[model samples]
Target: MLFTQAKGRNVIALTTAESLATVTGIAIAPAPARIAAVRVKTRGPGTQVTWNDVHSFGPDAVTVRTPDTIQGDQDTTAPTDKHHDPIGKRLLTETGQNLGSLDDIDFDETTGHIKRLIMAGQDIPGERLLGAGTYAIAVAAP
Candidate 1:
């Protein structure tokens, strides 16, 4: 499913129907190009919902086993470790040619594997993903 499709979906607690947070965005770990963590409107990690914390990514909602799964601000403190979230970052070639801004990502809902990246209307396969940081999302030159 397209990652954009998940934005705005409610984050639900598995033990109850209560809404914990709203799906706001995600951090994509590049090279392998997978969703490293899901960002939510709430939760203690300053909007982060680590992959390990997610119990399931359902069509209607994202589920967590418990509220504790929503981490506090105590995880990895390195700023460099948080550079992979690439929603609106510019897309660039490995040689430094600008492609465009990344609009969205197509990924497997269950596995979190990125399938392709959507920029404008073009689909760049996930394997072409080279790297991601706050500056740009790099892809292999065609």
Candidate 2:
């Protein structure tokens, strides 16, 4: 599933399947896990939630944080890890063939691990990726 699709989906509790909050954005860490946490914008005023404390995630929603205690993070604060915003970054093969700009990321819904990169509506396998830098994603030649 693409991260874009996960955004805006209602976050439901795993145990009860009860609605908790709405997803706002995701924070990707530079670590091997890829997705470090999720940020949720709750329904009430002054309420927000972060999924950093949670350990488990499903395809559609996460199974953490209740509706009442979920608090929001400072809007200006950024994630503390080294990260890259892949969207709009150019995609290139090892031999320098231009594919397209990155559109979205495809990830494992169950494990929260990034599976592939979506560029020009195509799926590029994670293993083919050589490097994801500030300007472009270098992939192995086909």
TM-score leader: 1
User: Model 2 segments beyond 4 Å from truth?
Assistant: 13-18, 31-33, 43-52, 65-85, 88-99, 127-142
Question: What TM-score fits each model?
Answer: 0.86, 0.56
lDDT of 1 by residue, 31-127 (tens): 6778878877774544567886788998889998877666543563312233555878899998999888988899998888999999896889998
Candidate 2 differs from the real structure by a C-alpha RMSD in angstroms, to one decimal, of 5.2
Estimate the overall C-alpha local distance difference test score of candidate 1.
0.78
Question: Which regions in candidate 1 have their CA more than 4 angstroms from the true location?
Answer: 43-46, 73-84
**Lowest lDDT block of 10, candidate 1:** 73-82
Q: Model 2: which ten-residue window has the lowest total lDDT?
A: 75-84
Best candidate, lDDT: 1
Query: What lDDT is reached at residue 53 by model 1?
Result: 79
lDDT of 1 at 73: 38
